[model samples]
Target: MAASCGRRRGRFAGGGGGPMMASIYSMVALVLVLVACVELGDAAAAVDVYRLIQYDLAGSPFGSRLASLNHHAGAFPFAPGADLSRTAVIIPVRELDLSFLRDYITNSKPLGGLLLLLPQKISEKIGQVRNILAEVEHLLLHANIPYPVYFAYEDDKVEALLMDIRRSDIAGQPATATTGGFKLVVSSSEPKKVTSPTISNIQGWLLGSKGEGDANQLPTIAIVANYDTFGAAPALSMGSDSNGSGVVSLLEIARLFSHLYSNPNTRGKYNLLFGLTSGGPYNFNGTNKSFSDVAKEMGVTLGIKHKKINVSNSRVAWEHEQFSRFRVTAATLSELSAPTELLESAGGLHDTGKLVDEKAIYRSVKLVAESLARHIYGHQGRNIDIFADNSNLAVNPHYISSWLNLLSRTPRVAPFLSKNDPFIAALQKELSEHTVEVHVQHEVLDGIFTFYDSTKARLNVYQVAGVTFDLLFLLVLGSYLIILFSLLVITTRGLDDLINIFRRPPSRKSKAV
Candidate 1:
């Protein structure tokens, strides 16, 4: 009997008498297995996210760019180009302090060309502005950047700059005058408003065609570029890194795409609009109206929506560092969310590198436009449309018009044909009658945005990247197994003790008798 007990002990310890120690070792091994499985699952999840990004960027002009991007996967590498046109009436509102731009140019290579849309109050400074602009341009010319530095004088500078251009008798007079000339003046007398008159005047000046028929019929794309402010109102108001960085990124992106679409290497198949908006009393005002107006036009436009992420904590430094060093890669409108999960598990635009430059936004826009155009039109000739949601600036065309009053002071309100009460009701009714399809991609952190196309009747749900649904599932399963296994070990140990007692020598039984 004693020998039997010893044999049982030997079974537990493998030719040793330390059965209890062996049981403890088994518990530790189980723990180690749990950790190993979790780590393995995590490694698998990271790999999946990488493949997903690659899959999303497979075809299009961006695909060519993607190879370079992939090589610098953890860095933000810039593509060479800017988007400006000879026939296009470019306008920029300099509301922020120009210190950032000035420093950007002085410290780094100056921006080759820019068409600034300045208010009338700053008209007197045209000479000073021109001198500074000239210096920037002169430097770029010296650098032989290949792209010409173009300028559009606005406000009083429009007439003033026109006189200067006409007097200078430059070689590229027509190209310079039309592209650089202030085509429309925001009549000094007009009230600040995005009024119909303003919209009409600016549209008439820039577009030269009237009605929906004349609007850029080519596939249209819109970008809703704005500052992603944190929850704090003051922070948003200050346009801190979130606001300033965000807007700069948008502008850079717009400039880049504008250049590409007009490039000789590229054929302009789509008409793209970059709406730099104001964040007013309301959230997302600029983009909302921009979207509404496009939908009302009944023209198909691809929409690329992007904003700054609230830098809530210092951890964002990593993202900033990554962004600064050019570790950040772009995604099409479809791929943006998915990567948010896989790369940055926190799922917000925190940069561990350098701050995301405005250039990144431009690159992203270019990529998205190229991809969508290719997807919709392919080799065949088809129009493309894109719409970007800006801030409330879209809603208050009047405010926008007032702001641009220095330029064409036309009261401009790009009203939402979609948000109009009557229109919404009509559309809702129309939608009920027709087979409209809606696609929604629910992100783990960010709320979902749905895409609806009545004409196609197709919908797809998108999941943002970086989110570990698979990893999450494995974690749950692995946890459950570990708990169950531990409990079973404890129960078996207890059972073995009972059996050993029963098999003990007969002395105890004889005493009981």
Candidate 2:
């Protein structure tokens, strides 16, 4: 068969072919074809999935937040129904490597989702980490794979980011008095009324804090985006935890609830509002005066009370030593803690729920809201809760402390200092004051992928069966070339041997005959 086939192709001299040679060549070709198919099948089965991590100034709060489905997915593949899929449990962070993600994906085997973390700026400390994450994401998309993603953060940390840097510096300066700093000089031509206020006339002077917002504006707050910049303060910043993170958490919860309120499936029974405050390198000045200013405006415009308003400072220490030497007094602590507890009690969640200082503030805010809801609904109102959902509370305590030191040392690089020329003296002063506080800080933010339910989205693998003719043709051509080469060598050697026999043995053969 092989000889006939080779003859048809003019690959050999077509004459002295035998059945055995034909069978050998046929078997050789079949084995080669089978080997090629097996190799191709193995290659196809070795497909890969990539994991991506993203980070911004703060950790990726959005990435760390696990979806409801995540819990379900995590509870899979175990006899006890414990999903035990640690892969989906560990949120993707922006500074992880492809190998790490690959292993995680393999172990968990998720039902197609994607986790998007905040974008981390390329810096010397983490450029390589960021690149690896990017490459993994690229590869996964290339392979047409999907996965779920989430992010998380605490609110108080964001509050620190939004602190009024100008005020902070001025307050810390030796030239200040009474912990006093720059004061706002409000200039207005409107006359102030002593008691009886006139209608449609600007006459109110708000010296106290009270609800100034409209009754209809859904109460909302901003949450910090999870990033490395949040958490504990830098050494230079006096190791103060910024309350901006707290504010951020509040905002996010409000935003999320607002989203829920708008959803057709879960809408109504709640009103939500949100506001984005300042964060990042410049300092917390942006959001520092936002609430107060808003309240003042409301009091002036509407006949509302604005009194006893204390903007929760994210710098409030949560630790015993920090608190012992902190500016807050025991009486103030009592007041703060009491209100927080009251709100918690009002929310009807529990009194034993414990968290860090900023997280406590977040809980307090939610509790306050819940309390108000109960007050409006005969003390048996439904639960209306919120959280500083994005927190590195899951991280190691020592790491948190070091991060606090870094923030303290971050230098007043904003409103008070020029971007081109840092306030070297001020920075030097902060560093020198906290020289012993410097430590390595690692901020871990969660990365996320989501497989949302309903008709909103869907994921399924669609495969088309067809022949890979090009590869097949290439393999066949190469096999044929190899066989043809072997045949040429064999035929050449045979011809040479035949000629030699005919020329040298002619006399012996004639004698024998």
Candidate 3:
């Protein structure tokens, strides 16, 4: 009887194990199948989106420079076969300026559009480039010229093509001679009106005093930088020089202050204001706005209420320290002038001492920098001090559209701030030490970028052919659900059987014994 009971128990166990094993195997198979199907579906649905952008490979002297300019312009120059009546004149950057623009508008024939070719060399004199572009835009607005002005960077291949066209059209006539007709004409009408300029000001502050001080009453130390930049032509007006270094430095300084002043327990006595102003190329428009806002918040009129704020006054004068391009000195200006002379002499052109008045331009830049600095720190009055690095002065003549590309090939030329610059070292020291007094004898200068000639483009599209949903995905899901249900049923039945086996009133024979 014992042996018979043992055999019955074994048979029951085997019966239960068979369905359990089948269910486990079925679940594993379903999961594997589902994973495989999902992956396959994902692969099938994936698509690659590509855009066909034409580049002036042969026309551009430097491949990257032209590519960058084209990217900024949003489109390539009009093709040769394009309608000339609807096209505009292409002016080289060298020919663009206040005087040249005035002459062109007054003397040149009616035009449909204008394309200015910016030179890559303008990257050296970014501030002057911006100023020139701004001056150009101002002239156009004043004259009420409605034609659309576009800017392109100078390219060798494009220039060659243009020369060939001119040669063919003139047919043995001197290249310098003009037919006296309209150089460019288009069907488009004048623009209706000029839109208002948009200037954005970014500001933040850290409380340094221990008590909850009235922000308006506290003496403020403002650290500022310009965030906007521009190039000469619309295509080359990338203000990387102004926006990249100056703004980056301001942000770093702000971050350090934030970390230091964040603790309420150890706050300093003075309030720290960080201002990152935009519209740098537009006569420091952003900075001007910032000053106005600061005045309003501090409850004091900038020039009226306070000629200079004293520590005893309820509204103490605000101290401003601005970070900008290095100041240009007399020696540097001379060095910059030497290059132009050397270039003209190299081209077999006589040095007329009038190639370009480098001294006058440098002086103008210096004056502008000084005036802007004074305006920013005017509140400080007699107490104001401006410090900067003359060696790293912002001087990029090729910032506009011109034929010259001065960068060396072996070691590509670029605008860079040295790690060991004394100005940088001094600024860093002041920030790290949190010193209230900083002394440097150098003058402060601001760099500007042109926004008038810049362009923007958007590339967003979908490839409809690649999107798909397959039956295999559904099949795999269905199989998974079915396997899951089967496992649930198997588990329930196994538990019930085990419980019944244990609950079955002890066999009558065993009970009787």
Per-residue CA lDDT of model 2 for 1-513, tens digit only, reads 998887766634433343356556767877887897666544111111212221222322211112222221111112223223322232224434465457545454444233222322323324454355335434332232233343222134212321332234334431122232222111112211122211110011101112355434533221221111221111112112333233233333343343333335543322322222222321221220122222232232212222232234432222121222443221111123323210011111011111124444444344433332343223333332222234321112343334333433343212122222233233223322322222221211112211111111111111112235556667877888667645653564455544554576558868999
Segments of candidate 2 deviating more than 4 angstroms: 1-430, 433-467, 495-513
User: Which stretches in model 1 have alpha-carbon errors above 4 Å?
Assistant: 1-219, 228-246, 260-269, 288-366, 372-513
Candidate 3 residue-wise lDDT, 1-513, digit = tens: 999999999878887777677678777877887787565434211111111111121232110111111111111233434333333355555555556457556554344445555554654555566456555544442343334454444566446534543554455321111321112212222222112334445466665564565756766656565544333222232333233334434544444345445666535566766565543433334452123333343343433221222333322111121122222111111112222210011111011111334333333333333333444335333323222224333333332112011111111001111234442443445344433333222211222211121122211111111112235546767787766655554565565654564585788899899
Q: Looking at candidate 1, what is the lDDT of residue 325?
A: 35
Candidate of highest lDDT = 3
lDDT of 2: 0.29
Q: What lDDT is obtained when candidate 3 is compared to the true structure?
A: 0.37
lDDT of 1 by residue, 1-513 (tens): 999999888777642334455467667867877797565433111110000011111121100001111100100111234222222222233332345334434454433223333333333444454344333332322232211112222445344443443443343323233232222211112112112210000000011122345545654444433322211011101222333333333343443343334444453444544433322112233231122233233333545455444434212222222232342432223223323311111111121112233344443344343343444234323233432335311122232222222212111111211223342233233222211121111111111111111110111111122225446756976887666545554455555554564586779879899
